[model samples]
Target: MQETIDLAAGPQHPNQFALLRQRRFAPFFWTQFAGAANDNLFKFAFTVMVTYQLSVGWLPPKMAGLVIGALFILPFLLFSATSGQLTDKWDKTRMFRFVKNLEIGIMLLAAWGFYAANVPVLLGCTFLMGLHSTLFGPVKFAYLPQVLRSSELTGGNGMVEMGTFVAILLGNVAGGLLVAVPEIGHLQVAIACVALAVVGRVVAQFIPSAPATDPGLVVNWNPVTETWRNLRLAHGNLVVFRSLLGISWMWFFGAVFLSQFPSFAKEVLHGDEQVASLLLVVFSIGIGTGSLLCEVLSRRHVEIGLVPLGAIGMSVFAIDLYFASRGLPPADGLHLLAFVSQPAHWRVIADLALLSLFAGLYSVPMYALIQMRSQPTHRARIIAANNILNALFMIASSVIAGALLGAGASIPQIFLCVGIANAVVAGYIFLLVPEYLLRFVAWMVSHIVYRFKVRGDEHIPVEGAAILACNHVSFVDAVLLMAASPRPIVFLMDHRIFRVPVLGWLFRLAKAIPIAPRAEDPVAYEAAFAAAAKVLQDGNLLGIFPEGGITRDGTLQPFKGGIMKILETAPVPVVPMALTNLWGSYFSRVEQGGAMVRPFRRGVFNRVGLNVGAAMTVAETTPEALRARVDTLLRART
Candidate 1:
């Protein structure tokens, strides 16, 4: 066993790159990075060899890419469930070493296959490499949450995502260049692949021990049964399951563009092979940029609000690409320089890069959310299930795009249709899980409507049941609070607020607990308390405006007894919070009329803040005491 906490020699800043300096993260990061690079390098080299050099009748040049891709993904479909279970049942550091050792052995075999110029042997190596990746996926994802704090999830995931794409990009470029060498291209590729494998194994030895999440678990070797079991485990949590589907949908969406890039560049852009590679480089850079931005945009927390924003950007840019690519003139095999020199090609390049960038922003948060929220014991298996879905979605995307192209739809038209369809599919997913939409709205309000900030946010609980008692200054106070907390906070609101048009619809969408005065509606009041208690019992945060309603004046209202009544049922820690600089805003009653009467009363990006205070234990939680704590926060500047 090893220490669960990651300790470093010196104090580290909050920057994501600071992780590279620590023992706990650096070695594993490099190990995985080497593996990713080696996989792409080997696959691309084999692909070039098959398509341009070899002439086996059964594997034609046209079908070689598809066949190789299918062979690579097949292992994920067959072994991912078992691999996830294995990940949970063994030390993760041991798993990394085992996978790297397997890679080295596989690469040795691959060197012989390349030297002998045996197509079957090379194909077998591809499947084996795929298996290597299938095993590495779950452990790589599951290891992060075990070592990093909740506050670090966004930044940590961002770094990994960025590094993976960059590795893949570098690998592809190296393979293309190395395999094109005059006489010793094949030999050079073999040596490079073997060397990369050796490097991965060397780095794997340094990863700190991450003890088994489920050491006592029994092994289930049957992929069929275990795959089903793994998926069912994921489905056990509605949010996690839906998130799995959402991420798979992203893969599906991106696959269409990635698969079509070669065709699009040659046919639509009238560019050479080099131009296609240029497009790939641009797209990879965009993804890396979007991924690295998540930590900064989210303030180093797992903020799913970026998911919807990313989805919207993906569609917007993809559609713009359709219009940009339409009515382009044919050119005579233009290379990278000539292609970019033509101003007409710039929009197509920009669109491709932006869509891929949005894809990065869209995916990192969901991945981190799954990592943070899934049961530690079952997290790897759920991630394995996610891999299964991603592979299936990618396959579906390829088949559908191929069929559409075969049916004579132009590449731009297919892109247009997918862009339109992305909006609908994403909208449907949001409907099923309203949390994404709620967070999106809150994210917009905080990012666009005001320069939102949080202080003492560390007081917010990461796990288990807790009650958030806050001084509600304005209608948007709940939104601000949602923006600040790393995890979702379900609020208990006055029932009357739910009838206020757009605000009401939003509250209902959030699944807020709607309470009324006990005298006016006793049944509804009791039902609200019961619902609130159930939320805590289920180990979820339940938020309340301890004043019972938003304040009309910029003063602290007395805490109501409803909070005390609910506390008697489930006496969890009470976190006091406050919102400042919002009372005179448009959402408040400062003007003669209420919200929407005036826009940006204080101007966009107004200075607004949420202040969280130390949590109060049940024994010290009184109406007066809670009010005083919240009052102190309300008066204190964040």
Candidate 2:
């Protein structure tokens, strides 16, 4: 059972931000924040030292950043599988403390290396810090859904993502500042690293105990076999596995831009290092802003609908960025001020900001969805799978981008190629999992075409098999219903309705059931019910028009026995719903004609609503009772 979030909390204390004051969230946030900041602080300080302050015989200045990055990423590839298993077998709070303690130890060693100017020791410490992050990664996501209710997942994830990016930004800024502090720079870097690690440990002490989900599971020590097993386990649920890939692809996409930032700023924008830092600042702030906005945009749920929206924005801005890059005025040694003084550069900044902002939106919902949907026992392992994939994808992005550059592709051309590729990739993913595209369509129509609102939406189950019985009002009724649900709803709609333009294509994409009257076509009717039964058995949501068909007379129609037929096939709970104010919509049978007759009868953003009633037990559900429930809901505010 999940804890109830304070949904009625006032604006001043929005439940998402209010989490900052609560024990369950605040401590974990700070602990993770400190760890991320410290990791970046140490790495950046070390990179700066190797690049500018001193040059070792083996490590050239140009290769310093790449070497440190490769070393840090190596641990994720090697140990994520093992870390995930430990996270599941041990108490999460204990794991948190252990990781924090390990951080402290690593930072202490790092302190000595910094003070002594020991490049080798610092490099080793960098890998150790990466190890610390790897150990902590699986537990961090797994711990959240353990404490937060499903309703709070998106907000919780949004806050954490925003915090993580901000922390990384601050750490990099601090690292650069500390390591440049004249003669005392190295000493300050060492002191700060140790202090931050200690602070992280202190915060870790306050995280509430999250009991092991799979206490008796035997640990798999082999990275190769264990990694393969974890990936296979995650694949048991196709959506979850595909989502893991989606997130990894996002990392790949983001890394391309991030890796090119320095070159992009210096070569293309004709700016110096300060200008490069400015680009970083813009990108970081954009992502943080988008992450924070997910909670509001999703209305505090794990809404994958936003994923498509985010993907579209990412591609659009990335493509625009290519064009924006080509038009910048040529100049030499232009500092931050000089770059900003030109109007053309503002487009570059805007394009970069919006592109990164969409990346944030793209990722947070998937992370929350993965956590919410995975088996609690193996959630950590699945997350570990995600981490491993992320590492691989980032490396691939670097290799591919490097190859493109080596093959004579300019930075702008590369951007254009990535932007186009993103669209094709996103389309393929949506096709594989139609639910994503379904949700995107529903969300777009409900949020844009109509001023859609929902009442009693919580009665809908987030998982498992359940029958949704809504009074059909228009051709797009299923689309609106999909908007109100977090899960994919396989709507059992009337066969004739599938002939409606555009909507017909969408329903086919959604794989909605098209049932004929048993008397009219017994075989088709039987097949529809059989398909619905399969959906229930597969633990998916099934939707039906309990009134048999859309009302031609703008009033509640007599109840049909279709709902009972579905329940008889699978004894899942039936949720009664009503769509209000759709009677006179353009899609409805109004003005003595069906759809397209009064196209402007209801303008864009027209007020409409879907009112959901309580779920009825199989024993309590009947055609008449379901009708009465839906009728009451329809009459509530009409």
For each candidate, give its TM-score against the true structure: 0.98, 0.97
**Per-residue lDDT of 1-638 in model 1, one digit per residue for the tens?**
45444433335456989989877788989998999999999999999999998889999999999999999999999999999999999999889999999999999999988888899999999999999999999999999988777777788888899999899989999998998898899999999999999999998888888889999999899999999999999999999999999999999988898788888889999999999999889988999899999999998889899999999999999899999999887887899999999899898899999999999999999999999989999899999999999999999999999899999999999999999999999999899988889889988999988888899888999888999988877777778888888878889999888888788898888888999998999999899999999999989999999888877777888888888888899989999988888878878776356665788666777888888999999999999999998888878984
Off by over 4 Å in 1: 1-12, 591-593
At residue 374, what lDDT does model 2 achieve?
A: 94
lDDT of 2 by residue, 173-210 (tens): 99999999999999999999999999999988888888
Which regions in candidate 2 have their CA more than 4 angstroms from the true location? 1-13
Q: lDDT (0-100) at residue 315 of candidate 1? A: 95
- Candidate 1 versus truth, CA RMSD in Å, comes to 1.5
Tell me how far the alpha carbon of residue 439 in candidate 1 is from the true structure, in angstroms, after superposition: 0.6
Q: RMSD, each candidate, Å?
A: 1.5, 2.4
Task: Go through the candidates in order and give each one's C-alpha lDDT.
Answer: 0.90, 0.90
